[model samples]
Structure formats: structure tokens, C-alpha cells
Target: MSTTPRIEVAAVADALYGKWKEERLAGRALASDPRLQTIPGQSMDEHRERVLEQLGLLVEAGAIQRAFPKHLGGSDNHGGNIAGFQELVFADPSMQIKSGVQWGLFGAAILHLGTEHHHNTWLPDVMSLKLPGAFAMTEIGHGSDVASVGTTATYDPETEEFVIHTPFKGAWKEFLGNAALHGQAAVVFAQLITNGVNHGVHAFMVPIRTPDGQMMPGIGSEDDGVKGGLNGIDNGRLHFTNVRIPRTNLLNRYGDVAADGTYSSHIESPGRRFFTMIGTLVQGRVSLDGAAVNAMKGALAIALRYGSERRQFSGADGKEVVLLDYGHYQRRLLPRLAETYAMQFADHKLLETFDEVFSGANDTDENREDLETLAAALKPLSTWAALDTLQEAREATGGAGFIAKNRLTGWRADLDIYVTFEGDNNVLLQLVGKRLLTEYAEQFKDGDVAAIAKVVAGQIGEGAARFGLRQMGQSIADLGKVARSVEGVRDPETQQALLADRVQTMVAQIAM
Candidate 1:
């Protein structure tokens, strides 16, 4: 492939890229730090403690402080922060995710969704790891469907508070990363009801632990315990029953309820308001996408390195075949190598778009929507790619890969959840397809038959060219043989045009 894109194992210029360097350096520090290593038996209690200790090391190093406000001791280079945050997957996926719980999910919810008052009250402690928290949004039965979560925050004008309740068992938030341990609080999501009208799911900073460190009243929690991997995080479930807090507890950027139980907001459209509130934290998806891409690169690097060095067969005396030289091995790896490259290129573009939307560089509704869709589209692809790459790399290593000492198997096992945990791959892709469909339908919203006709005619013309209706045979047909076509594809512009054209053609066909 002439037009090859390169994925970064160590990227430059991205805000997250610089943070990756810091993480690399920090990872080195934890290399000898005993607390960073996973325990053999891997019980929840034992693992959570080790991770907490490791968090202290990370915080002391000021690693997670990179993308926040400088006044709060953060570097505030939003994009670069995530770039580095993702590289932690190399050292340990557990560390990467646990740190994400603290910073990416928990901290981001506060940073993006909360007001300055909320920031002043909560950020410093949270940023310093003095107050670890959970992003309690994913209910057990409503993981992807946030709109219909069974929890509620009913406004009480009598006390100027919102009483949070998990009205149904299904509303008990589950699989929360920090809930079982380390977290002292959570940014809980619940249906916002004021004056008897539901305003949809909204977030609230609810304390789960007291100052002396006890689980708060009416807050029930249970550890999710161990299974496949990423055991370092204390995945858990939380349920709220009559959890009452001040009305200000609501992270009311998009909407707010008054002491009189009256509701009003800058965004009048409830759907847009909800999306706007949620879109503020799209960085979680962006960062995850980048990290997943990095994981793929790491697997490829280790696999490619070992492949080059640890040869199998011989074409000559005492010469084992360099794995890359074998067409079979290259066929197995090279296309994925190309795909990883595409994901990397696409993710960088998406992250840039995310920064543009979130960092106030060009924060428009359209840009925010674009960023969210891009994140949803690519995160699943990259994460699934990482898991596959890791598994393939592990398999390539044969017996050596099976042993935990090589790290690939361990990484592979840990990454297994990536496919399902973050918004689930199929559901996420469905969202992407819907977005594309929405965009397509808008083109015909005016009932413009001419426009529809124009598109159909263009698609038919393109299809004809592709299948040789326009030419006697084919435009480049028999220019030579396979070798001739290969040579033509070798030109970067040719490859890029062909690639871009294929996407357009496919979409047009699907739309029709």
C-alpha cells in the first residue's frame, strides 16, 4: 500500500502525546515500584489496595495533573494529557483504566459538566487523589440506554434539595470502576424531576464516603469481583435510596431546578440539552480510542520485534526464517498493520476535533456533535483492534506468549473487556450508522426530488465506471496483469483516491 499511515507508539505534538512521554517516564518509575505489580491470587481486596498505593505514586509524580487547570497544578493541555494517559496501557491496562476512572471519567465529568462553584469545591481534592470518585452513570440494566435509567432526583422545594432514588433494582449502578474502593464520592446520574416534570438523566456529585471514611447512609454498594482481567480496578455496584442532597448537587450546566421547583435552561430542546450535557465529556471516548490504538502499536512492536529476532525455519544452513520474510506471517500481520495505521490517523483527527469542541477553540453545536459521533465510531474500532492485535501477537509467540512473563497474554486478557464494556461495539456502530443515516435524510428534508435524483444518477454513473459500463472493458483493465494493478496501487495518490472513493461508493449504495 503506497498511501500508508503511521500509528504512534510514541506520538509528538498532541497534548496527549506529551502526557504519554510523562507516563512513560512515570511507568519507568513504577517498574521497580512493588505496588504497581499485580498480585498472584488477585483477590479484589488485595488488588484494590495495591492500585491505590500506585495511584499515590502516580499523583505524587503529577502525572494525572497534566490536562487540568495550571492554577490547580494541572498542565491544561487537554489533548496531550490523554495522549500520555493512554500510554499507561503499555505498563498495565489496569493502571490505565484505574487512572482513567480517577481522571478521564471522574475528573472529566466534573471539569466539563460541573460549574465553577463545583470546580472550586471539588477539583483540587479530586485532582490530588485526596478524594477518589466514581462516575456512576451506567446502571446495571441500562448501560447504553442512559435516557431511560431508572434512577431519579426529585426536587424538594421544601428543603432546596434533590432526593436521589434508585426506584427500581435495575437502576443500581453497576460495573463502576472506582465504586468498590478508593472512591469517596460519585457523580451520580438520575432522572431530573422538578415540579412533576422529568427533565431527563442528569449528574449529581453524591458523597459515598464520610470524612472519617465510612460508606454513607442509604448508599448500598457491592464489589463486582474478578473475572477476565483489569482486576486492578475495584469494579462495583452502587444503589441509592432516598439519597438527599442540596439542589446545587446537580451538575447544572445545561439545566437547573430552582428552590421553588421551577425549571429552565439555556437549551430549550430536551434532547439537545441532554446530549450537550453528555457531549462535554466525550473526551473519555476520544482518549480511550487513542489508548486502544497505542495498545495495538505496542502489540505490533513487541510482535514485530520478536518476529524479526526469533526465527522458526531455515532456507539455508543455521538460518531460521525471519518471520517478516514469510509471506504467510506478513499476510497475517501486514494488513492489520495497515489497519492500525488507519485507526491511528483517524483517531488523531477525532481527538483534534474533540479538543476543538471541548477546549473552546471552536466550540460549536455542530462541532460537538461531530466530535461525539467520531468518538463513538472510532473507539470501538480501535479498542476491538487492540484486543485482536494483542491476541494475534500472543498467538504468534506460541508457548512463550502463554506465559505471563512475556506480558502479551496478560495484556490480551485485560483488554478482552474493551469490546463490550465501553458502550458495546455493536451498539456504538449502530449509533454511527444512525448518524450517517440522519445526515443522509437531512439532504432530502426539503423533499428535494431533484437532489435525490442527482445523487442516484451520480451513484449510477460511479457504479458503471467501477463495473466497466463506461469503458469498453475497464479504465485500467489489462494495463498489465496483477503486477500492473499492483504498480498502479503503489502510487500513494492512487491508493488514497481509491480508498476515499470506495467509502463514498459504499455509503451511497447503502443509502440507496
Candidate 2:
């Protein structure tokens, strides 16, 4: 009798669906609805308008309110909120990102950075789609270095207001989602200058347009015309020429300015305060990570299904072979399929950490730092993997994948920006690297030689085991022949040990 391994489909699916399975399924149902799906070949203007309409549909379906406070009509289920939000990639990446811009960035800035007054005044409108806004943080001069953005919010004690200004061309806010047309307001980030003290970067609620669609005084808007992808979002630039907003417009949860122009913050260090405020908005990266994974899943689904059915050249038996039955075809997509599963579980873990921190259940400085580092580390890998997987899947399907209707080409184009936005992938990884170094240094800071020796010894053992030294010993012990390294490499524990050792080696090298 011969034995063959069998997969439990339902069990695997349940594991992949994760803790927020119901929310993900609900999002999938919404994504599957024809009204919300993307129409290939639509012009930029048409696509933008269609996506805007879809936002209203989402509001009606009550799909955009999960992250808000329950008293304000949301369920406050932060993890579930993201799980559902990520599924929008199946419908349209543009819609997913645009919604993220509105709620996840703009409104979330107010919710997390602002006080209760700002929330009571703004979040209701935000949740209902009645007030569309832009998150004006990225300037032409600054992308990842947000703390150094050229825009300024200078205090005016005489007028009791903060005058928001883009002093130079470089300071103009660029690539904002709603600035091209629909945004009536923006959460503008700028250096807060109060009482002649430069108090680092801060967010201010600045109205850019009136209800009648006219630009507010001292505010100029320019449309960012067609680009590589996500044109469904009205990406545009905004500049402020001493635009005055009320003193109360400062979203000052982390730092605040008094009416007398005195700046005060719970965190005394300007850098720490800025990071704490920014860390509150880590949801963007969290959602993008999951969205990228979802995109990979969709692409693989299309390619794998097509490969299993679409017949190609003749096989050994002289019948036209199914594409998936070919060795090279499986080689091309199976690894990506496995990687997507890994990314899915990784994203779920990240989401759980985000919920723990945001929900205040496990909100601690250490945990917040861990969450940020985890997001920074995983987001780049997943997004880059998504692009790679999508492209490979496209190529595997041959001409059929290139066709617009199949979604591979369109998704590849749209997701091209993922690796760069929500903090550029390279920059994010640099942050992760920095954190790893900091943690590594802390272990040695206490000058415990025994502890250091143990750590070094453990790393050496791991390195030796992974690099064949221990395996060589095992082969010699078994007989005078080398053991099959491939079999050991396939073991889960061995694979993990190898990866961990590699990271340790790199970190040790850098520290030295």
C-alpha cells in the first residue's frame, strides 16, 4: 500500500481566515458585489467619479464605521475594521486607498491626535461621507521625513489662531487623495511655532474649500494629473498662503498650545512626542500590509484557476497538458502561493498587535514600539512580495493575464505604489534595522559579561548548526558519508533556526 499526504481544505482555510474571519468574509461579499467592482479601461475622470460614488455606497452599507468609537456609531473593533478594509482590494485598489485616505489617515489624524472636542465635531461627518478631506502631510520636499516638512503653523496670539503657510514651492502638499477636487478640508501637518519656540511638527484642521466647492482664501489647489496607478483618487497638490484656522483647530492630543501661545506636552522630548503622535496612525501600514497580501491572493487565485483549466502544449501522453500540471508552472506559482499564506498569517499577527495597542488593553510603551517595528519590518516584505507575485502570476498566464479583464495587469499597475507609500519600503526597513540595533545594544549596556558570553555562544551554536558544522558532525557519526542536507533544511525548526541565525549574524555584524 502506498501513502500520500492529503490537505484538509476547510481546516487550512479556517486557519488562514484568522481571528477576524467574519469581518473578512463580509468585506469579500461587498467586494464581490458588481456595483463595487472595478471596470477596466475607464478614463481617469470616470474612474474617480465611480470610486467617489462607491464611497457613498460603502457609507450606506455601514462598512466604513468599524474603527470609530461606538457612541459615535462605530463598533470600535479596530482589528476587524482593518480585516474588512483590506478586502476592498478585491473590488478596487483605488476605492480601498481612497477610503483609507478619508477615514484611516485624515479622520484618524483627528481622532487620534485631536481631543474629544475635535472628535465630537468632526468624526460624525467623516463617518457619514458628508465631509470628504485630505491628509496633507507629504510635501514635495519631504516624504518619509515627515518631521522636517517645510510647512509651518505659526501662532497668532492677537487673533487666537494658527496661520498655516507653505512658504516655498517645496512646502506644497503633494499626492493628497482628495485635493484635486472633492476635499473640503485637510489635516495639515506643519511645524508648530508658538511664542517664538519651534515646537516640532503638529496637525491642524484647515478648511481648504467651502460647501459650494470654492477654494478657501489663501489656499491654492492644483490637480495632479494622471499617473502610474490609483488615478481613481483625485491626487493633487495644496499650498497655503498664511491660511488662518481657529486656535482650536490644532489636533493637540500629544502636544497643545494655550491661548496665550504657550506650548505644553506630556512628552517633554520633541522627538518622542512626534513619534508617539505618528505611531498612533500606524494603521495605514497595517492595512496596506494586509491589502498587499489580499492582492497577492487574488492574483494567485486568477492565475492558478486559469492554469489548472487552460490547456497548452502536448505532454508525455500526447494530450494537451494543463498549465498547472507542468513542473515549471507549479514552480512559478506554488512558492508564491505558500508565501501568500505566510504573509496572511503574519498580517493577522500584526493586526492583533495593533488592536492590543489601540484598544488600550495592552497599550504600553514597549508594546507600541514592538507594533511599530513589526509593521515597519513586515509591510515592506509583503508589499514587495505582492508586486513580485502579481508579475509572476501574470507571466505564468501568458497573454490571458495581460488582458484587462483578468485583473492581473491592472492590479500590478495599481499596487506599484504600495512599496513606496505609507512610508517607503526602504525607509521603513531602515527603521526596523535601527530598532534591532537598539534592542541588541540594550542587552550589552548593563556590562554583564556572563550574559554577553551566553548570547554570543548561543549565536555561534545556531550559526554552526545552520552552516553545516553540526550537520557534518552528524554525518560523520552516522557513517563516513555526508547526510542529505536538503532533508534537514526542509524541517520547520531548521528553517526557522537558519533564518534567525542569519538575522542575528547581520545584526551582530552591524553592531560590531
Candidate 3:
């Protein structure tokens, strides 16, 4: 008889579902509805229209309001909102992204960056789909360098308005969702200049189109046409020419301007103020991390289910061998399965930290900084892993995976942009590396001479160990005993110590 215990499916599922089980189940139920699911072979224009209609359905279902304030008909449930939102990947990645553009980006800017007056003026319409909008932060000339964007919002004290202008073609906002057709307004990011002094990047509410879909004066838009994927989004470019809005239109939670063109902010350092404003929008990365993990789960489930049933060749007993029974197949898929589980757990932890900061339960500056760094580090890894897993799953399923109806190819195309959008993977990893160096340097900031000497001595010891000067005795004892060397690393604690030592050595070298 086999000694292994039977698996408890229900208990395992409950644990895997994390703290927000009900919200995730609700989202999954909605995603299973045919009306909201993707139609594989639809035309680009048809897909775009279908997604727009689906956004309305989401509003009717009350699926997009959980993150807003309770006074505005929302639950103020930050973590649960993301838990639910991530499940939309099952319906369609395009739909998930389009909905994110509206509620997660555009509406969130108003909620986090703007004051109560601005929220009351715009958020209700935004929640109801009465006012579709765009988040215009990336320009043709500036994608990751948001601090140096070319668009300018020059304040005019005489008329008490800000003149928003795109001085050159490079200043035009590019790749904005909803800008081509449906957007009626946009939260535009530009350098704020008042009294001939540039006060760095700030956001403002600017009308881009009329209610009936006419482009507003001084605002020009151009369609991006068919893309490699996610055609359901009406991505486009927008340019401004002397477009003017009221001074009060500035989202002034971080920084503000007076009627006489004087700039003031509670945060004195311009650099600190800019980072604080941008950090509030870190939920974009947090949500993307979860969505990518969900996508990895979907891909693995499809591939593993197919692999278990499909058979090939014959065994010695003359029965066909199931694909998954082969060691080679197991090698290919099982490690990815393990990685997907790890990513999901990491995402859950990230979501918990996010809830802590945003819910004001532990909203200290240090906690916020930790949240930002965590998101920056994890988003890149999960998204890249999702792409790798999806491709492997597709290849594992053979001819069936290539078929449109199987959803692998379409999903791969849709998720290709996730690595670059919220923040480029390379750029985000650089941020994490910088944060690591900063943390390392902080220990030496107090000029503790004794502590510095100790660290220097430790580095010298590590160098000696690396060069075999200190490990010579152990090497001589272990010579000609490869199994003994391998046995040492077989212990988990030894493996962890080696890895931790490697990281500390590399970081110390970089810091010096």
C-alpha cells in the first residue's frame, strides 16, 4: 500500500486563495460570464467596442468601486479591491487593462493626488463610466524619465489659469488608453512653471473631448491603429497647444500654487515632493504583480490539464504512456509549477503590505518607502516569469496550444506589454539596486570609526576565503571527495548560508 496521504482539495484551495477569498471568487464568477469574455477572432474595431461595453457591465456589477472612499459609495477596501481586480485576467487581459486605465490610473490620480473638492467634482462620473479618461504621463520624448517631461503648465497670475502646452512634437503624450475615441478628460502631467521658476512635475485635470466625442480646441489626437495585441484599448497620441484650465484644477495634495503665482508645498525639497507624489500611485505596480501571477496560474492550469490526458508512444507492456509520466516532461513543467506558487505567495505578501500603507493602519514614511521598493523589485520578476511560463506552457501543449481558441497565444501577446508599461523591467530593477546600495551606505553615514573598521576587516576576511588563503585547510581535507563537497550543500542551512554570503560580498564590493 502507498504511504502518502490523500490531498485535501478544499482546504488547499482556501489557503491558496489568501485573506480575500470572497472577493477573488466574486471576480472569477464575473469573468466566467460569456458576455465579458474575449471573442478570439473579432476585428480590432469590434474588440475595442466590445471592451467598452464590458466596462459598463463592470460598473453595473459594482466591480470597480471597492477602492474609493466610503462616502463615495465605495467599500474603502484596498487589498480586496486588488484581489478582485486580478481575476479579470481570466475574462480578457485587454479588458483587465482597459478597466485598470480607468479606475486604477485615471480615477486613482484624482483620489490620491487631488483634494476632496476635485474628487467630488470628477470621481462619481468616473465610477459610473459617464466620464472616461486617460492618464497622460508618458510623452514621446520621456517614458521612464517622468521628471523631465517636455510638456509645460505655465501659471498665469493675470487670468488665474495655467496654460498647458506641448512646445515640440516630442512633448506629445503617447500610448494613452482611451485617447483615440472615448476619453473626455485626462489627468495631464507637466512641469509646473510659475513666476519664471520651474517647480517640477505636477498633475492637472484637462478636458480632452466633449461629452458627444468631439475633440476640444487646442487638443489634437491620433489613433495608434492595430497593435501587436490588446487592440481593445484605443491607444493614441495627444498634443496640446495653449490649452488653458483654472488654477484650482491642479491636483495639489503634494504641492500647490496661490492665485498670485506663488508656489508652496508642505514638502520643502523638490526631489522629495516629486517622489512622494509618484509613490502614491505605486498601486499600479502592485496590481500588475498580482495580475501577472494570476496569468501564470492560468497558463499552468491549462497546460498541466492537457498534459495529463494526452498520450504518446507505447510502454513495454504495450499501453500508451501519458505525457506527464515521462521524466523529461516533468522536468520541463514541474519547476515552473513550483515557481508559480512562490510568485503567488510573494504577491499576497505584497498586497498585504499595500493594504497596510494605503489603509492608514501603518502609514509611516518608512513603511511607504518599503512598499515602493518591494513593488519595484517584485513586479519585474513576476511579469518576466509570467511571460517565460506562458511560453513554456504553450510549447508543452504542442499543436493545440497554437490554436486561437486555446487562449495561450492571445494571452502571450497581451501580456507582452506588461513588462514595459507600469515601469520597464530593467529600469525597475535599477531602482531596487539603488535602494540596496542606499541601505548599505546608511550604516556608515554616522561615521562610526569602529564599525567601519570592523566592516573593512570582515571584507578582507571574505576576500581571503574567496582566494583560498583561508579555506586551504578545508580544501586539502576534502580533496578527491566530490560527494563530500556536494553533501555539504545538500543541507538547507548550508545552502542558505552560501547564498547569503554571496549576496553580502557582492553588495559590499559595490558599496566600496
Which residue pairs collide, candidate 1? 15-79, 15-80, 15-81, 16-79, 16-80, 16-83, 16-84, 19-84, 20-84
For model 2, residues 291-334, the per-residue Cα lDDT tens digits are 99999999999999999999988988899999998898999999
Candidate 2, which ten residues in sequence have the lowest lDDT sum? 463-472
Q: Write the per-residue lDDT of candidate 3 for residues 259-279, one digit (tens) a residue.
A: 999999999999999999999
What is candidate 1's lDDT per residue for 1-512, written digit by digit as tens?
77788766444335334323455455545544555655545676677777777788788867788778777778777766766666667667787788888988888888888888998899999988888999998998898888888999999999999999998888899999888866899999899998899988889999998756678999999988886888888999999889889999889877888779999799999898887887777777787787788778878877888777887879677777788888888877778888887787787788678767656898897887788888889989898889888889887777877778677777888888887775788898998888987787787888889998876666665644542233323435767465555666566666676666676677666887
- What TM-score against the true fold does each predicted structure earn? 0.89, 0.95, 0.93
Best model per TM-score: 2
Q: Model 1, residue 47: displacement in angstroms?
A: 2.2
Error of 2 at 327 (Å): 1.3
Candidate 3: which stretches are off by over 4 Å? Answer: 457-502
What local distance difference test score does each model get? 0.79, 0.92, 0.92
